[model samples]
Target chain A: MNAGQKSARRIAASNGPIPRDTVCFSCLHRLTHPSRRPASTAAALAESPPIPSHQQRHTNPPVTTAKAPRKAYQLLASPVLSRPPLLTRDLTSFEKAYYLYQKRLNERLALPFTRYFYYKKGTPGDAEWKRKIKVRKTPARDIGVYAAYGDEGWNDEVLVGDRTAERESVVEALVRDAEGKAIIDEEVVGDENKDGLAVAGDSKTGEGQRRDLTKVEVERPVGRVTEADTANDMRSLSRKMDRTLYLLVKNREGRWRFPQDRVYGRENLHQAAERILVQGFGIDMNTWIVGNHPIGHHQMNYTSGGAPAPRLAKITPNRLVSTSRDRAEYEQEEYGEKVFFMKGRMMTGQADIGKNEYGDSEFRWLVKEEVEEAVTGGYWKSVKDMLAER
Target chain B: MALLQEVTSTFLRRFKAPPASLHRKWASHCRHASTGAVAQETDELEQSSFLQGEGPAQQAIERFDPAGVAKRRNRRLPPSRYQFRSPRYYRGPLHPHQPPRPSEPSSREFAPGPFSLPRLEQTYHDTLASDYMVLAYAHLPPGQTAFKKGERLRRWEGDSPYFKNRPLRGPRGGDTLRLLRKPVTFRNVPQLQRVTVHTMSSDAINSGAALHVSGMVLQAITNVRAEAHEVKKSVAGFGVRAGMYLSLTCELKGEDMYHFLSKLVDVVMPKMKDWPGVKGSSGDFSGNIALGLKAEEVALFPEMEVNYDMCVRYYLSPTFRIWLLANS
Candidate 1:
């Protein structure tokens, strides 16, 4: 037979249980509506009946012709749809939520994340030193900054694209571009390392506030960050393996949402922080503040010149000790000789993302830098000073 | 990217394909025909049932019975069967357990080889369409009757026995069942696997969309007469009925609920064409898929409820595996 006929025969031969015509007949016989209502369709399928499927064989042979069904009569004499060992299956709520996400989220469009184990250095008080990380700060650091994107109820009161969250306004989350190099630069405004940075929330909450919020955490080297030392020298660093840059999107409900992979990493990181404070010189002489820190936070940040910085991008400090103990120990071991470790007063901070800055639509904060000279010129005393300027 | 593995094309490639143990070699065979034992049993049953079904044919054949049922069969029959039962039911000296005993070689060119397929225990089916497609559902109008299998499809002058004067065909069962165009060869070694059955309705089937069914039962029926026999083993001697299949499947799934009936009407029944001799299309079913895993994790169920008057009907679809890959 020619290939077409050969294939047709093969198909027909391979088709088990029923003759090809019967299947064709069953298809049309079961058709509640003609696939396409060609004027000739009714004429074509006139002999067919609608074959309903479900449960058990409700009615076998929905239609019978004088020709009779000589095909699978043996099938007709068989058992009803029920077979033995009935199916049992179950799913949980979170699993159901994951399934819901899986259903609606297109795999192709799905961006994912991965995490590795390692500890970070410093206490929540470290944010003050994290920005001054010896690691060369670049324009990229400014990209994720949103000055107004602080913890003060910004998330609840305003939504995405709010006038305040708009790029054009003073309330907008903005970062100084290369052209405006002097905006956040220590050389232009004048300030001490890590000293000017403060949590953006109620003053009381700001105490360890930066440790409570959800933010992108890029591990960097912490040359020697002690809970006593603020983040005066933390630098956001990236490793070749650390290619993931979490971009939290907003769900329809206007809540910041990340994929499960990202969430897993964030949660793990939170549980991996240490509450002990490093004893040493900080913002001023005798401040001697105790602060929460990821023990190995120092290694998480580094200098662009490849040198290890003293801190990294501020992450929510984990108060629960066991989860963050490895990190705490790693940092303590790495810099234990240089700094003294001590427990501090609620070294934790209130850094959760809130609607205080922008209305509750989806939004990401972009940190900007003042002109490189902003700090060296001694123009700003604290992050409040910087916020007040704009 | 290259394929993780490949199977060469050749005859002995599957069996003697090496590294495979002698036991496996012996176990993995498709017999040419059911053994004389199975044949004897099935034939006796088939004869009794056939005789009980239609009397005239049996009377005509009885006159020639002097040679006996087995001996007089093949020799006296016409060379080909145009409007008669298949001779496949005959035992012809082969074991049903082995997929196929090597067929006796023939001199004819391109002679079809043995029926070397595995035991028809469990099978999967899928559509062969290559383009992106969807399932749709529709219902018959208020006054018009549902389209009949052999009757011509009637036009709705926007009128009908349907409440909406519309004719609605259910979801993608035809396409789902279409996958059975070729029965797949799976292990007959008795392993667990999930068989997904999708249920969809008329409007959904017509809309050209994949139906989504969740938290509902799914079932499927392929044209397997041997499967019927397998089901009959339970009652041992009682006559097999279409209804028995459901309970058998439900029992296998470990569910005591009348899933077969629910699954049949809720899922499989709506998509099935009427089988001959069966009366009502909507009744308790005794069958459902013996799923190996939670369908939600592996497959999706079609969910679409049409509300027209206060009444609502659900739609389910068939679980299809062999889809026409778009890239192909």
Candidate 2:
């Protein structure tokens, strides 16, 4: 072989390959000697470190056990379905007082009312409005001058405005005039019948009808507290308006935990969780699983002293194990159970455990605090971090 | 005039008259009247007929009826001339009359929406955020320090004179530094920030029709106005010339981004023919993921389907590139 061909072969052996055009001795020298190379080329050569033995093993086939492996643990997919709070949390007394103070300050600094623009002159409605304003006796404009300087206008107490007085809603206020006249007419008729004085009652009715024009019957707002809250109904989803409620079911073993079902056949965890929801609670509810992945997992190890009582046999009867002999064999073979909890959300509908195909089971919709109290200490420790404080 | 007098007399009677002595005492203590020129002016003030209760100005206001005015003129009254118009361009901060921010109602760029919170957003807040935190948590026993990865940039090894004060070298393999995966917490939960819809049409260089169609389709799908981008460099192979508008891009944020994603995932993607789902290997190491859609797949969107004939020209079709960015 020629010198050029010999040098090219040597370069190829060291650096994988070289271009056909770069087969000259000078090119071979540049490729082989690091001192003669550019800074970038030298740096690139130094960058790659030798791969560790652990990583190198990835290229080889995986090792298989010579002996048969121990029986796998039973896998369960538990869906922790919850309902988010419907209403904002109740305001504290301090928050209420601070908001009221800010409102009063805003009113004091507001521009003077433009009465002429809103109320036309010589109109009965306008006259009635003016009369109502006269009774209020609020300053035309305070501009905080009185509050700041302690003038005669300052009362040395919380500034009381017309808003402090119980005011009817706009709808009630608008219909008040018509309703007031009817009420006065009824009262006048009653007075005339009782006293046998029609002539005197006729004059009194005219005055009363004019005076009661602004009177309105206001309906009180519905209270935030629901019947479920007062009754302490743990089964009702609507019990807590301002808290996230989780669904915890009591298994046949009388243990409180999230509704879970064993993985059947080749079904995945997500599909298993969905099946558990449908089996534990009837299909009347609308629910959605957040994702395919499990949020958390808890492993319960079975003691080697044989199967610790079969909880599944009591719940699923013949469906899971078929016969007593099969049940005993299945229980003894399984090492333990691993429960993977998937997050889910309930939009509507309540749990109908009684109508569920998975036999009779008691269920409760509980807040975070109540859930901690209802569950066992070990189960609580495993799940407490996942539950929302609110 | 008679009606006005009668209204004033009724008002006076309805308001109880204060005691004469008390009224005088209160008037004498009035702060404004106690001032310099105002005190002298009060003594000369005369009760003119025009200044009486329900004056001529008040009467004019009572007679001012917008409906009647419009009827007399035989046309609707013009909109109020005092309505504010936001400036189209914002001057520098030192300008006397500065333009309001884009978030302000008066700003020209103010686009208000998010009329209702999205279901996906609600789900993220209610469950997903906390679930992510729980799943990503790594327990460290008390007094134990976290194991950190080795420095990405190489430090000079040899004590050469030139290397004494020199900066560290760039990252080993390449100059690009990867984003660190910080432990997930309540404050640093991953969240979708915005979505960018982009389309490039080589056919646009020959005819503007391709560019226009792409822009319109992107706007319809994203609910945002598409901006045309000029080619920065000329390429002979692609038949694109520098300064030619051959691509369209639209950015969606907040409500628009969520709505677009939901529509794409729930409606369009499932209906796509022979779809293999987004490739698992499609994301940048950072939090951004990009997916490409053929012209046929873009046409499957409900918006384009509704007006199929208007935008379904196969020759003018443009492939779409969608980028989803998440802030970690």
Candidate 3:
């Protein structure tokens, strides 16, 4: 055999196989020489595949079974097994309030839970879903505003305004010590902790900040609501939704529109809008976005009061037992009530059909095409305008 | 003096209540008085001796027969008496075809006769009595009539498709009733094809330690050392690039597989919270059932669980894919 053939055979014998490719020559040379290789490699190369002597050295020492503790398998099977210990303690009132407040705040500020998605049933631009938003006026107390602040206007404590300057101010006030000096830094007061409870915002502020009700001499302009006062910020749906708007429909009656509610005395328009949403369509204000401002408004001539009424009436008018059946309970009065259409983004709650003014109103989330087909007359024109803007 | 005394007594009776002795006599008269019925019955029995002698002179004794005694030992319970109220027998027919047969009085014309004998061929208005077959049919109730069976038997007289190529066996050696056919042989092979642990992380591309630790975790959990694989293509947006060790995978077979599976099913899986047992539908149609565990859950293995706190954050939960090969 030639010298090259002999070396190839020798290399194969030492290191299994050597590929006749680039850069393998050096590895072959290293395998042939024991002195050039590392001690670990040399030791590994000393043993063959099936039963490696080097692996034997690495094996764990034989365990002395004589006095070893009984294994899990060897233990006597008992009827009752120990349970995992409880990891929590009953919450104190302060902790409970803190968590509850945090939950509400999170729910209010968190992104809408549901995404706007619909199947393209027909051609694009065909109205699918239609809904009407009802607007009226009611008393502030009915909308959960208990104690009114003396024309500061409404007490931030009593008012369920989506946002107020006093909300941050109250938190700023609580961060101060008994001497009324700022204990925490200004930044900390503004910053929400991991729990998002606004560590500075205390439950005491909701009660302690209540001021006595007093009439103000100065004329306070009403209906001045901004985006901050309500969570009207348009949130993009998570999925790639088709360019379609779904109108909320009341029942199977093709009369599709956003459910509307009345504005109560002492209640801001946004609060009234949410109240209407809750009562009319069973949409919880917490889980949905009721715009601070009305998207559209229409005037209807009916026996109604334009200005906020002293007391709020039920959304569903109750027929008085004393009144005659022939006489309409809700007869037109002297004045026309201006109805505002507030746009709302549905988040996480289901509409309670049982709570609807009209018995058994089935709310359908219909697409743009279906909405156009379902709604007609003045409603159709208004909806068309709304869709045009989109 | 007598007139004065009578007037005084009369005046006293008129003015005051009656005397106590008179009231006692009146109370005794109002009370129910008992009659001496016992004495009268004894006197009557003594007078009428014939009336007492009407019944048997002595009590009847139970007779013991030898045959009856022997038969009692071998007495087998009647099948009907054992479950006499069985629903199978007592329950009315679900959908009876005909109304119940009405009873008819026996007549002379319908009496039994030798109608089957050809010598006694006689035409009569009572067809059932004249013909034996008709009589037999009449004897049976409507429900028990074998008209359908007789028709089915007669149908085989012509050239039958079932007996076209084969000779028909007589009533003796016909088709015998037997149990169902043999059970089907299943070709499903449950051998472990391969065991792989896959991990994906943006951090691994930058820090080699992440890849090493992942491989270590996979090896520690499975007891089979894993090989680290790198992403061949660069995806800049996700920070994934070529030659970046993105995953660690291991394959197990034979004993290693058995040990891993036992630990997974017996120990690891049961410890998981909110785990509704794996549904039968949770597979890719193939035999392989892909099971995923959270990082904290995968740390339940002895090796990882021991030093869990130390490398808790570093441990990325890799999906342990167990492929089960089946013989097609």
Candidate 4:
């Protein structure tokens, strides 16, 4: 037996005449030792120097000790008064409150987050047919910010005008003279022709004027080829490995896609996907989810500079961008990059085309058949599993 | 003259009163007529004491045998020679599980290959079309009949006189009636299609750690990271803003949805203290189901269970919205 139990036995044996109080060892220890007495007689103990341990006895009936020790002894002697082995206690009010608050927060966050998988929906219109035909002499590559365009009210004429402007820019870039002056004065002539087309297209729709204005000032880079354009083409060379479903954007490249951005070094696939949707498509992150899990992961090989490399885009704390001239030194080279495709649905609003800073002409929420028709080969095969009919 | 007048009055009074006692006696006699046969049979049976403790009179009770006195042979016809037989039992020389005989390679083309693929032309199904899109329960009208299945509902209105005149020769032909006769089973009954998870911060609006923890917790539960859901409008009461990262959310559908439900109901819910399950009254009366979960209760999920000690301090109760098709 430990010291406390030994002391208990000694006390019990010495006080044989009276019924021994089979009190708890800790309580008995307190009684036998004068220094560790409870504060019930603290005042009396303080007034006089504490009774020495050797002189202390259970029979010594001091006035201050009499009432307190008897009560304590009675409580200790009770069979039901045994202490638990672990000596744990129930949570305090403050801790309980904190737990409750935390619980409430989890419940609020655990509200089932919904993600929607939308395909490019609608019958191919005349303008859409024209956009599908490659206007640029160069192939349309997978680079640049392409995202789901949700707004449907925008007119096709504006999109057409935007396209023509983009074509003109490309033509100008391709046909530049040695002095960098345009050999073609076709822009002015093209403008006049487009204006005529706009008037005719406008007579068919009410929003003709807005369409005309947006064609000139649309933020999405239409025909301009960036580093991403070349990189995307190189990366997407092998159709066997990489699979991607493209969104059909009217007046822009027909192949817009579910928004995806480059993953920052620290961020994971889902975080990057959410970031892409929010920044590129103007989706409300809190209201929607990319998906409960990634539908698929696609890897593509590419060559940057001269060596075979994976495409890497510069990631700012808030947004992802293609490498710029100023930040070239700091640009981190990422190779063999993997893209995770997830299903996303809007909880509050339809596709917010207004927030789509990248210029996509119009959005069509496609069905499974339409999605299959819009995308080809490996991408369609992967996407077919995740298709949501509703 | 007085005697003659009194006699005439008495005669008039007698004609007017017309046999009151006689009418009552006739009514009592009719009542007895209605019950006479049944009452006689019961009275006879009771007097005989047939149903009382066994006596000599109890043997008078008769019994009927539904199948007659003797049992008849119960048998079925033997199988026909043309009936299909299982290959395992009769067709194969060896057991069905036994491998095919190994042979030396004749040619690489003739040899069994490890992989197989369909031809390009044969890659797709021809029946897939947009026209087949049928919305299930897009809306629900109230009432008992509205929610019940197997009812013959007028899904379409054939106003044409031609259709009305030739019901058997309509678009569906004779099968139309048969199709209508098929009772709507539970499979055909509309169920929840997907569940949406909406996560919001219960802590300070701008606490980075709280948002991070919320996102991580959601990720662990779903096996996919939670996407940030920005507050669309600023609320003074909650100190939220239009573009602030308010919470994270994700949608679970098909396998993910059912799997999560199984975990929530089977694994997590039983561990919670004093937790009553989703109330029947909690339904919107259409078809959608919504339930709230406390953070502590959510922690019981296998995903979050292991992390209790290093628990994310901030918590937010989340609502799970199960979307189902409403009765159209």
DockQ of 4: 0.01
* Model 3 lDDT per residue over B139-215, tens place: 23233322221111222356667766564443434554222222122222222455555655556766777766667
Of the candidates shown, which would achieve the greatest TM-score relative to the real structure?
2
Query: lDDT by residue for model 4 over A1-390, one digit each (tens)?
Result: 235543444554353332223455344445556566546345544675554465445443221222212211000000000001111122333333333333223322233322110112342233332232222111111111111121211111221112222334434434432122223333433323332134334445643332342233223334334354455532221211112213333324555344444444344445555555555446442333432345455554456777875444443433353322223232334455455665443333334556664465555444345556655555555445545322
Q: How do the candidates rank by TM-score, highest first? A: 2, 4, 3, 1
DockQ of each: 0.01, 0.02, 0.00, 0.01
What candidate 1 gets wrong by more than 4 Å, as runs, is: A1-270, A273-352, A355-390, B1-229, B232-328
Give the native contact fraction of candidate 2.
Answer: 0.03
Winner on TM-score (2 vs 4):
2
Q: Single out the weakest 10-residue window by summed lDDT for candidate 4 chain A.
A: A73-82
lDDT of candidate 1 over A1-390, digit per residue (tens): 123332332333332333334444324333323344554445544554433344124323233333422222100000000011111112222333333222222221222211110112453323322443222221112212222222221112222222432223311112322122222444423322232343556766454343323333333334232442243321121211111111122335544322111111123222211211111111121111112221111112223567643332222223433333333221111111111111111112221233222222332211112221222222112111111010
Q: Mind giving the per-residue lDDT tens digits that candidate 1 earns over B1-328?
A: 1332343444346666367676767766543222212323234343465546643555564454432444545654453542222234335557442223223111112222111111112111111110001111122335444443432333444445574656644333352211111111221212223232322222322332222221122221221111111223333344333323322121122121223224333563345444242334422221212222222222222222211111122333323221111110
Better by lDDT, candidate 4 or 1: 4
On DockQ, the leading prediction is 2
- Model 1 chain A is weakest, by summed lDDT over 10 consecutive residues, at A74-83
Q: How far off is residue B202 in model 2, in Å? A: 1.8
Question: Candidate 1 or 3, higher lDDT?
Answer: 3
Q: Is candidate 2 or candidate 3 better by lDDT?
A: 2
Cα lDDT tens digits for candidate 3, A1-390: 224433543544442334433113334454345377556545544673543455344322222323322211110100000111111122333333343343333233333322112112342211211100001011110112112222221122221222212323333333332222222233333332311122333556553332323312332223223342254322212111222334354534545555544433234555555555555555432443333444445554432356532222223232321222332333122233455554444445455656765443555444345456666656655544433111
